[model samples]
Target chain A: MHMADALVSPAVAGAMYAASTAAAAYSVKRVKHEDDIKKIPLMGVMGAFVFTAQMINFTIPGTGSSGHLCGGVMATALLGPYAGFLTMIGVLLIQCLLFADGGLLALGCNVWNMAFYGCFVGYYLIWRPMTRRRLSGGRILAGSLIASMLTLQLGAFSVAVETLLSGVTKLPFSAFVAVMQPIHLAIGFVEGAITAAVLLFVYQARPELLDDKGKSGRQNRFSYKRTIAVLGVFAVITGAGLSLAASSYPDGLEWSIQQVAKAEEIEAEGGGVYAAAEGIQSATSLLPDYAFPESENRMGTSCSGIVGAVFVLALCVGVCYAIRFWGKKRIK
Target chain B: MSKIEGAVRELHRVDSIAGADRWIHRIYPSVKLILTVFYIAFVVSYGKYQLPRLILMGVYPIVIFILGDLSFFDALRRLRFILPFVCAAGIFNPLFDRKILFYAGEIGITGGMVSMAALLIKGVYSVLASYLLIATTPVEKICFSLRKMHVPAVFVTQLLLTYRYISVLLEEAQRMAQAYALRSPGQKGVHFKVWGSFAGQLLLRSADRASRVYDSMLMRGYQGEFSCAAVSKCRQRDIGYLLVWLAAFVALRIG
Candidate 1:
């Protein structure tokens, strides 16, 4: 389910870039974190493991779309919130450049949506509480299912929101969310099962791995203070600079859907014979995300640029606080 | 002076910037990343209706591909692995996108043709840009730039360590596969159960070893920051490299 470059607009792309840069900077800060230098290997190892795992594909039954594990959720399960996020950044960056799985311009969005939620929220809210002292297979299974689904849902929704704000999509918010959330929900379910399987296998053979990491102690996990500072500085620059350069047009899919829908509604929207032909593809891309918007007729790309940066940073802050709140309430 | 430079050179060869004894290896990754973004941004901005702009955008990267200094034939060979995904994604575009945005005289085809072409260009252009960047820049220099840019000390450290360990784990996986091949040697050789269990075991072992290695690294005063590479002082000639591209981007954007 990779988002294509053709699917994103410049405004949305810029904004996401700003947001992602901030997140990346924040992640670097999050990982090195005050002196617990051991997290370095933790991040690298997890990234490598995830990369290898992704290379090993699994069949998807009748669909025949042999999808591999995304590894974000699994990373969260193994690493704590902050470190998990950093590892994912590594994985996504590597995947984009070396493997060519996702787009360069779209990398920021993909990493943030897939990694951010899967790492922080998935861990603190679901995995941590359930897996806390006495781990249960049942708890792991249930937590994995819920957390994975929720993470995908948020990611899908974020794509929708970004598209809309960038003015790319023509679909109403509710309809778009309805279409995106459920499909991603199915994908997330399958992903969680695989993650649980991998971990369960490890647990059965060697629960000592966790103990080993824990004993590796202050060196292994990450330093919070310094990581946050470094990340915070980058995020600030990205958020500020990106905000200044964003475009005003609607995003890609949004523009097409809106145009086709408008043409169908009015007999002479484009007033051409090709009008009916446009309807067919528009009808098929009916998934809420079909509303991907590329703003075509906008005047100022600059104002939207500023808005994109501001909104992404604000959204990230919202997610951080939301996960913290979720963890506090859920964990004993 | 000569003694210190030699030691540093040896240390660099042994650790970061693996085999980066070429000219293209000197460009900064952030510069590459910036240019790639700007390139894609310009490509996607043209209304789907603008054919000339689209075609022109597609050509710019091809020029870079030629200039990137890699053997033309070898460069194309590198694209063999990449071609499949681009083909897969593009193949679907025309089939799914039958909207006749424009008609080519008589025999009918969908706008998906243009969309497919667009997707292919986007794919090829970005891939070419990245190939140029990675092939030229030593991974270490990029990490070093990241450090100067204040990327968290930990993230940068992990990228380097993870790269180091990839060889270690890959060797282990390779050996395990070899042993498996020797044991079964036939259809049974590729059994999922055997490979699955083997991968699982390797994973746990690697994790444990990595943790140990990390602990020792910490003991050795690795405070997460690498000494930024002393790139040869930027010469006036370097302006030719940076400016030529900047000029190209502006010309493309406004033209």
Candidate 2:
């Protein structure tokens, strides 16, 4: 569910960056508490652990394909949400730098989609509540499976939503969701099972790690409620903004076209001001039709296709050579 | 099996390049970092059908790659894994958007086709820009610059430490995988049944190592924030670099 930079517009990327950074900032602040200071190395090491875990791809039984763990739910279950989220940022940063698995700009979106949901939604809503009554192995497994699936689903949906909002691709919202959700759902099940096994093993090894007082403390009045409230408000604001943009998008495109076509309509009415404007437009326009010259002959399409291909190829070659030339001169 | 080994080497490959003595490696990391973010933001900010303008912006990555003394083929190789994602995001465009954007003679070019081309261009360019940045800049410099830019010290420290220890953990994981593979011959990958215990063992080992690392840090007078002596001072060229690229990006965006 990693989104490429091309999949999002600057607006969508910026919005996600703001959202993810806010979450990261919140986590950083929470992590700065004196009590939380000692977990820094643990967070770092766990981040490494996550990175390494992804490499050990296990084959799914009865299927030839192999899959790896996502580690977000497991991280949260092991380290608590605040540290878990930060650890995720670390793992993601390394992955981006080393593998280019997700590019730099989309890092924020990747983190938001993959980390935030897994750490917060998985931990608070599903894992915590499900495993609260008793720290049984079965409970942990079930919690991990459900929470992992939920977070992956949420992440996949966000990818679709972000792409739609950006309008970078012509993927309609429903179609994009239809394609992304089910595939991610399958990946989520495998990830969930892997997560459960890992968590269960850790729970068996160190039960205190899973049931720490800080994590399970019912006395903390502000933790879950405040976080949920903040996230809810953020979601509402973003949702409202996206909906407004989505509704206006088609009309916006048509309106721009109307301004061009309407220029002729105004000329038909024969106003002096309109004629002068039309005269200027005709004189200044490179393409007289203000769009691609519609030719009835197939030759224009074929010719342009060849010409455009050559032009693009030549441009790329020219740029590369120029850079190389400049580099050599600078070195000399 | 071999995938694990390949991954470890790939992770190290970039770090090895980052240590090379190039002008890009010498520049203030913050400048390169900020410029990369701006370049991406500007590139992606364009309308979906703005293919020509997006193509112009591709110059940024090419220039950076050459100036950084990096190989274009190496950069392209790094981009191999990410192309599928870009393709997946865009493959349905021609199908979903059949509206004629314009006609080139007898043929009607759909908005989807134009946008798909634009999307692929944007994806490749953005990935290249990011890959170039990492290839040229060391992780420590990035973390240090990030700290200088007022990113939380804890977060930066985590980034630094995590990067440092990734190799160690990978080595450990590789050992376990080798052991598993030796015992279970002819298996293409690890059996799903052992994934629990296998990953469990890795976690146990990592937890033990993490505690040991914390103890070692305490013994070395490690405080919460890492204080390094090699603070990078921003030079005049750094500002010039930023302004020139910023101006070019703004111009392209306007186009």
Candidate 3:
């Protein structure tokens, strides 16, 4: 579910970056307020542990293929959400830079998809509630399984939505969602099972680690309402900013909506909000239909553009070789 | 097991190569980071059918590879796993979009074909830009640049520590895997039945090690933040490099 830079437009990427940055900032603040200096090294080591764990693949029963741990739910279960989210960010960033597992520009989307859902939504909704009053083997297993599957589904759905909104692909929204959701369901199941196994082991070995108060022995006082309010404001800002940006580039979100609804004419006759937005869109649209100003000789322009591109590539290669040659002479 | 070993070696290879002294490597880390981001943005911002313009963006990576004394084939080899997935994502483009875009001789090229080609180019270019940045800059320097950019100290501290400990943990995991394989031969991977004990044991060991690590840091008067001795100042050439790349990116976008 790692999004490549090619799959997202700048507008969508920028909006996601803003959202992820806000989330990260909030998480850092919360972690700092806790003031557990020991968590610093623990978060780092655990992040590395997750990284190593992923490389150790396990064989699936009755299937020829193998699966590995995602560790988002496990991290959250052990470290709580704030620290877990930051640890996942560390893991994802290293993967992006070292292995190219995901793209740098698309890091925001990947973080939101992989880290945000599992750390925040999985913890608050599934893991916390399930393990709230008591700790049991069955609760640990069930919580890990449910949280993992649900978060993976959300992450997969977000990927589909992001790709569609980017409008770089020709995939229809329904078809993309249809294809993405089911494959992830299987992947999610495997992830859930493995997460359950790992968490179950920890539960038996060191039950204190799985306690609701977390490792610091303090109550987890993170407020759901406050978080939601902050994130809601971010969502509103991102939505408005994207809408304004999408107006100028009609081929992105606008194109996706048109394709999905097949309702290009609805906005043509609508009043109120639609009419006002349409007015703003038309006013801001530089290339109304994503077409350049009329060119008399289109083929001629294309031919020249191709030639210019080839010339520039050749020039780049030539300069590179020249630099290498000069460096060799200096060394000699 | 081999996968784990290969990954460890791959990380070392990239890290070692990044220490090489070269013109591109000598350029400021933050500047290269910004340029890489801009390069990717420019490549992605192009229209779907704009294959020619997209192809032109390839120059940045190609020049950087040569100047950095890096191998293009090595980069491609590193990207082998991801490139296929990237291609697979766009493979449906040709099927969904069949509008005939232009004619080549008597053959009618569809919009799908052009966009598919454009997507492939975009993927390769973006991946290369990121790989090149990390290939040239060390992880610590990159983290330093991130801190300089006002990314929170806690996150930067986490990133540095995680990177530092990754090699240690990989070694430990490899040793454990070797032990597991020796005990259970003919097993494809650690069985699902033993996953609890196998991974759980590792997790327990890791937590213990982390506690000891924290103790050692505290002994060294560890604070919540890290300070670096070799502070990199932006040179005149760094500014020139930034301006030149910015101009080139702008020109390519306009052209």
Residue B201 of candidate 1: its Cα lDDT?
Answer: 70
List where candidate 1 sits over 4 angstroms from the true fold: A4-6, A25-34, A58-67, A156-187, A205-332, B1-22, B27-30, B71-112, B177-199, B215-220
DockQ of 1: 0.15
Best by lDDT: 3
lDDT at B172, model 1: 60
Give fnat of each prediction, in order: 0.25, 0.70, 0.72
For all the candidates, what are their Cα RMSDs to the real structure? 16.6, 5.2, 8.8
The DockQ values of the predictions, listed in order, are: 0.15, 0.52, 0.59
Report the lDDT tens digits of candidate 3 across residue range B35-154. 989889888988887777777888888878887789887678756756776777788888999987655657766788878888888888888888899889999999989988999888
Top candidate (TM-score) = 3
Instruction: Mark the 10 consecutive residues where model 2 chain A has the least summed lDDT.
Output: A213-222
lDDT of 3 at A38: 90
Q: What is the interface RMSD of candidate 2, in Å?
A: 3.4
Stretches of candidate 3 above 4 Å error?
Answer: A213-304
Each model's number of backbone clashes? 32, 0, 0
* Candidate 3 chain A lDDT trough over 10 residues, lowest sum: A287-296
lDDT of 2 at A276: 89
lDDT of 1 at B28: 52
Model 2, span B1-255: residue lDDT tens: 776788789778877998888777888888989998888878776667666666778768766765565887877886777889888878888988887766665788887887788888888888888887788788899898898889998999888889989899998888988988899888977788778889989988898999999999988888887885494689999899899989988776543
